[model samples]
Target chain A: MCTYETSHVAVEGAGKGADGWFPVTEATVYFDHPVAAMAEHTLNLDFLNRARGASARVAVELDATSAYALAQAILERLEAAPPALTGELHRR
Target chain B: MRAMDEAMRAETVKFAGHGGDEIEGYLGQPLGGGPYGAVVVIHHMPGYDRESKEHVRRLAAAGFLALCPNLHVREAPGASPDDAAAAARAAGGVPDDRLVGDVAGAIAHLTALPSASGKVGTIGYCSGGRQSFLAACSLPLDAAVDCYGAFVVEAPPPERGLRMTPLLERAGDLSCPLLGLFGADDQFPAPAETARLGAELTRLGKAHELHTYEGAGHAFFSVDRPAYRVEAAVDGWRRVLAFFGEHLG
Candidate 1:
């Protein structure tokens, strides 16, 4: 249905794109028609470094179930980490 | 049948877009000697990718000069189409004023073509469909086609990040015949919304025709996507070509 909804976030991390690894400064998330995915609409996420240009991006398109599973897994893994190993200072 | 035998040329072009900014575009035209009508192909929300370019070439094969402006070029110069689309979306989509200006420049470029017949039209799909209606309301197009363009008669929810308003109020300014193609099962511009638009245009005495294909949903014309409905797409194309032929000739 061409859902124009989008969510943007500023992040501090590195992602592997076409040109090896680059620090991603932001992320854009949306559920919309995919560029490569065969589905009519999918959960799309783009890790981008705007300073490096639009080409500096890592993208993924996943179905709703897969996206939800991935999100839960991320939260579970993060929460399972010990406080000493994943301290507040180390987060940055 | 002639389209099957037509010799055509398709290539990348550069032109002045909104605010005279140099932007990239795709140009496609038949190699026939005589003059031909022109069409401005507005890329859908997914951006100026393969399918959009294919639309331009198809029009050229149908014996019309066609051009599609890269609406995301400014946001991500030289970026891949998908990345550029992401950038544009993050920027809250293109401004309406900018879209009108870019289409104006495209018309200027088209009419200047030596083989142009001085008549021009526009056809847009998805978001471009709404933009096509917007452009027709603002520009002097000979004809306009809106294929499942939502937000024309109703506003999107506030969280959608689409910085656009409903364009129904501008119907009085529509300078050409309009052909609306819709899917009955679509929720965005539900059948009721299209009906309202039809009613408004009728009251205003504007020349128009609208058809909603039952059992078809949004993006039915998108062959690469699961929403594709061959029956609807084929019929829609036939109507589009006929409309363009009548008005642009």
Candidate 2:
């Protein structure tokens, strides 16, 4: 059963892929079939560089628990860091 | 008894697909001159990967010319299976017209085979299951099999913004005897949904056989996934082989 519940986000970052690293412009997050992970369904995130081709992608498949922890950790780290860390003025 | 067996070969080939687009496909053939049936095994949404190829080989070993077309070549040519699948999903899976074209192309390839018996059928898993049913409705096939496919009766929840709609209305157009294998515990097509599909087919007087295995959920036929149910997969294979034998053979 394909849940077909996909979440997409536009992002600006460089991600290492099969060939090397490339600038990723989009990230698609979905809880669906896992390509490599053992779980039947996992929180999958694909950082994609569409211009660089499909191979230029950084993909991750994580179980629900792991994905939740990752989200919390990301938020906490960002809260503790200075806004200048991203070389930007305000996060808002 | 020995006359029934034949050595088999498997490899990748390409043919014209929907809109004259060329795409790669895996072909498996039994090395024999005696006329034999053919099967077009549709890979699941995971993309055309090893499991689907294994299914092709299995069918070939059973004396059928089996083929599994890469449904993503147009989206990501030369890319790895996982990458291509991701790209295809992002671009909104394969369009219905394109899927039908690919299957038609596969059937053409099989019919052209010198050993082919001129009989071809289709079997698909997961999302491919729904597509298999769609192909049967849209094309003239000898047989069709659906394994734990969803969205045949209900569209992917409206929130997804997917353009797909339930295919039950196409029942009158089905061109072959249908065999539906489902997981009783699957939530997507839940037991009730499959029941609804069966009822509609019955009302339409379509030739079909529907089976739902107990204790199995979505992707129960996937050997690599933890959801695989041996009891279900084993019996399911028996049903598929027998179904194809009766119709394609």
Task: Compute each candidate's TM-score over C-alphas.
Answer: 0.96, 0.97
Error of 2 at B229 (Å): 0.6
What DockQ would you assign to candidate 2?
A: 0.73
Give me the candidate number with maximum lDDT: 1
Query: What TM-score does each prediction get for chain A alone?
Result: 0.90, 0.90
lDDT (Cα, 0-100) at B44 in candidate 1 = 89
* Residue B154, candidate 1: alpha-carbon lDDT: 93
Give a tens-digit lDDT track for model 2, residues B73-129: 888999999999999988877888999999999999889999899988999999899
Local distance difference test scores for all models:
0.90, 0.89
Clashes of 2: 0
- What stretches of model 1 exceed 4 Å from their correct place? A89-92, B1-4, B159-161
Candidate 2 collision pairs: none
Please name the candidate that would achieve the greatest DockQ relative to the true structure. 2
lDDT of 2 by residue, A1-92 (tens): 48556788999889999898789999999999898899988999999988888898999999999999999999888778876795462545
